[model samples]
Target: MPILTPEERIGQVLAGRYRLESVLGQGGMGFVMGGKHELTGRSVAVKLLLPSYGAEAEIIGRFFQEAKAAASLNHPNVVDVLDMQIDDGEAFLVLELLDGQPLTDLLEERGKLPPEELFPILMPVMDALAAAHEHGIVHRDLKPDNIFISKDLRGRVTPKVLDFGIAKLTEGDSSVETRTGGLLGTPHYMSPEQAQGHKNVGPSTDIWSMGVLIYECLTGDRAFQADSVPALLLQICTFDPIPLADRAPELHPAITQVVHKALARELPDRYASMEDFGGALFAACREAGVVLPATLEELFPQHRPTIAPGELSAPPPPASEPEPEPVPAPLAKKPASKIVPMLSAVAVLLLVGIGAGLYLATRPTPTPPPVAIAANTPEPTPEAAPETPPEPPPETPPEPAPPQDVTHRVISEPAGAEVVLDREVIGEAPLAVTRPGDVASLEITLRLRGHVEQTISVTEESPEEVVVTLPRRRSGHRVDPVGAPALAPR
Candidate 1:
């Protein structure tokens, strides 16, 4: 099979309905084009695989698998795959036409973004990934270029996740097309395991890529920076990234923590799922005081409206429109005075009869006295009882004393340092005295860079004040502490 000219390729059939319009994008395996259905006149985006790609059994299997996987997912955030077919020795996929620019284009235009601006866009992307993961799909290639942001007429941004070409489906019994040694994803966004060409990439791999994308969005620089692909891969696998604080001081510590955890070289350290990743990202945004957009769908919508080539006219009115029925008037009322007098007369007669019946019922007959024999028996029992003495009253037990409340003030080396109490972080230091019994236990943890963690506990009788001095760690030097910080009530 030979490569078709640009014009010849535009005449392909997709699902035996859509006719390709013009080339939209060109890639190694296929090209996407603006297309329209001939019968229904619905517009769509058609992706056609080149003849060379279709000749490879593995590539063809992967393409159809992507279509099948995408078809199973029906989410607003994910691009819809309408149909897939092989025509004239070329494979084609009919998709919903999206009206938006790729996230890569936006990022290229704007070097970096604040948390406020970035999270709203990133959230929907995460949502799409979450949906895919739920369906047993892992989007192995999650670069910015695969995220499309479409704007509506009102300028609302809607983010739609696209291109599941390299997605891994966990549920299906079918094997993956690529072998262990072949590289399938872009280097910059690939996970450490992915960069190593591991065949068993999972959801964690997607999380790592998302972290890299987020890091790039926030700092205008990739987390793993190296001169070559091999160097970048090595960095991803072995190097610990510089903390966001060191490179981007404007970013908050909480925000850096989330990104750092996401970018962790170890898979176990990253967020467990896309939902968890999204939640942490939003939390970071809030910690930084960054507000997100109203709705993600506002960023992208189907661009091509359904319209015939020559039929431009008004749509028909709705078929059903019912009129409301009229309400009835109220009826006239009867005279209340006549009705009340008759009812009161009946009530008086009834009460008189009831009182007479009660008097008759209360009248009772007289009773006779006990026999002489019974009185003698009672007298004999009384004489026998006189010999026994009354028992002493039982002794009362003493009551327990009330617990005394002891109060103690907490004092740190730095007078006004922030404090964490029982895992709940309280406001800045110089905290007032705390009474024992107020809480189950009082454990104070102080956080200061380069300093060993300082913890102090407090109880009723042993309430004490603490003087915490943070020690500075020398650069490139490690410290072996004598013991873990102990909790002592003061």
Candidate 2:
């Protein structure tokens, strides 16, 4: 008999039931087919393994293994496995026909998605994971390709989890056990522990992958990228993903915090479970005033209120009225106060005198070379003493020398934060400036976006290079209004 391709194998009736229509899609382990039940004539998606792979007991076992894993989960977000069979050299599994495309395709079409758009889809996926986790099952391979997003009859974009081929049962179900240290997940989506091929990868591993997925969904960028699989694995192990908030500042801190917790490398540092992660995500959405969609149709609801062209040309809708201001009751007036022109005059004069003294004290100092000259010059003998006798030695006072200039280089962790000297904007950071040595103090400040203003005291003993790593602003820190220094006159 001639060998038939997977597509050629299509249309062939299998076990007197499913009649394959055409190849729907292909994957690393198996390909899906659009088919109809012969007796019922109902539409369904059939997943089957390649014949060559099916000939092996292990691959055929895994094909059935996936069917078993998915059959255990009873959740709407998870793909429902219907049937499985092995006929001759062919092994196939049947699944519900999804109405929409994979998340991978959607992401490829749209660079990055807004928070409002991704929240609903993510909510259901997280729910599915939570349900699976409760049963001690971990979806070891979770990537955009395995996440099927479909539109139901109601037009709700429902996201369903697909492909449990490599899923590991943590409760010791005694099914097929993954060989220890066997690499079994997509490189880009693998967690640090998973990438390391650790023997006992747990739910936290799935949580890490979910974090990377959410990050990409919100930011339109991969959390980690490399040229090859080994390089990608190294990235997963060692690199700190660029923070989601840094890429999308509009995201609420609560949402970003949830991601940070989920992606934490250490087990204790990360969210304890999917439940905690979900709760935090929901709390963040609530705090941000984002209402989650409860209905299937709400997955891709109207992002902004729809307005007609005519309405756009018309005056804008009135804004919400502000709270009424309180009116204070009238109070009795006090008697007239006496003015003090004499004290004001004294204060003005004192200020002027102090300013003048400061100016004189900072005057350019002259170098006294005569003292050095005297030290270098040799005294004349007794012959020259007669001529020198005419000029009586007179007491000469030495003058103070002028201040020299010193240079200091300033730098910051994220370069380009504004540099301030004594509250005056000198220049942006990564700067070199010369200051007079006579100055009493140099108060240096660095201001960067999303970070609290950093201040430092510079002295002569300070190092030549001044570097400051600005810290993120603390919550509840007061924002000071613009003003000058308060002065108390004596």
Candidate 3:
């Protein structure tokens, strides 16, 4: 039954209600068919799960999960879930048909979206995610492919969030949960917690994915990248994203702050909720002077104004003629003798003012007079008083010097490991690591592929040269420690 092509399923009736009329779309899971309600003839989209997946209880359960999750959130920015059914072991969902394209297609067509075009579309997505989060649902797999930019009959843009298939319910709802430490979501967009396969993934996980998507939308590139999936996941778990300032320096600082906050490696440091994330982003957009639609209705009004081609190129209407200016009457000339005396008086006053200004400007700043010691103040005891040597004998002895900075020659058994001194990466081992003289001790962290990370402290009393032998990781792909400096994106 799974062998049939999408065309073969056309003209077939599902549960004697939705009749598959045409193939709307297809994916690895199954086909999305344009259908009509048999009784009402209402146009609808039917998402048919591939017959092979019907026997896979997990997949079937998730199929129904998407329906329940999406159906529960009746938001303008979220796609509407109509009905779901399983007929002859073929599970499917009914969704409202959309007119436009997925955000993936738009990004492909136009490499980078400018702030003016991006905020309207992006803000709504944030709002939709915020609504989903309110219901304790986290869309773990949010990416461009899951964001559909739909157009109403009037042709106004209204983005709808799609594909809640892998969504997780955080409130212990009836939705199926991903096994503990099971990895899900695309490699590039996974949060640190997701890459570590943490079971307690929450709203902050979605915030991380949104940050990646936003970074890509602003600068046609992924924030984190590597050659392989495991390598990418490791990068996501450990490394910081390529800085937005480097990717697109022209972007406003407010926007970059929001992005970095969303992409924070530590969950506690990240936005607390989708509302906070969206509010910060929206505020940043406004600060950057990027105008956004107040609401979906305002964005996609019931009736949109249209202009003809001729009107676009037509000349504007002419203005009324201006009145002519009146000519000024000639003034009587003043007597030469009277004018000379007045000029001389004016010159004398100007000279006096100039001399006064120069005198004030050239005056030197006065030194403040020393204050006399108070008569009632207590006198210093003989032991407390410093011996002046009766005169300023010789230059004052040099003040006791501060603790000298210590430089340690650090080397790992496996050379070329990343060496971090006091949380700041100082070249790779074998390297001369330095610590501030003021600090009592310095923390040194060494990391190398396939080995467990090793951290040691260095102090003035410790040996100048230090050596560490790292043990091999029990698992080849161990989750690396996060909060390192961001690796520049390639």
**What order do candidates take by lDDT, descending?**
3, 2, 1
Which is superior by lDDT, 2 or 3? 3
**What TM-score should be assigned to candidate 2?**
0.57
Q: Tell me the deviation in Å of residue 32 in model 3.
A: 1.9
TM-score of each: 0.56, 0.57, 0.57
Candidate 3 global TM-score: 0.57
| Candidate 1 structure, TM-score to reference | 0.56
Q: What would the per-residue lDDT of candidate 2 be over residues 1-490, giving only the tens digit for each residue?
A: 6777668977888767779898888754457889888877767888776554667786666556655766666566788666776656677776788899888888889987777778777767876777677767788778888788889777767788987634452212322223344334467887887766677777898889899999998898899988877798787788799987789998888788888888888888988777667767776776787776533221212322343211222332235867679976554443334346777889999999999999999999889676534556777765544444466688787887777777878877556889887678889989986767776346777898745577776656555777666543312222121121211211
lDDT of each: 0.67, 0.70, 0.73
- Regarding lDDT, does 1 or 2 come out ahead? 2
User: Which residue pairs of candidate 2 clash?
Assistant: 156-296, 365-402
Candidate number of the best lDDT: 3
- Candidate 3 Cα deviation (angstroms), residue 338: 36
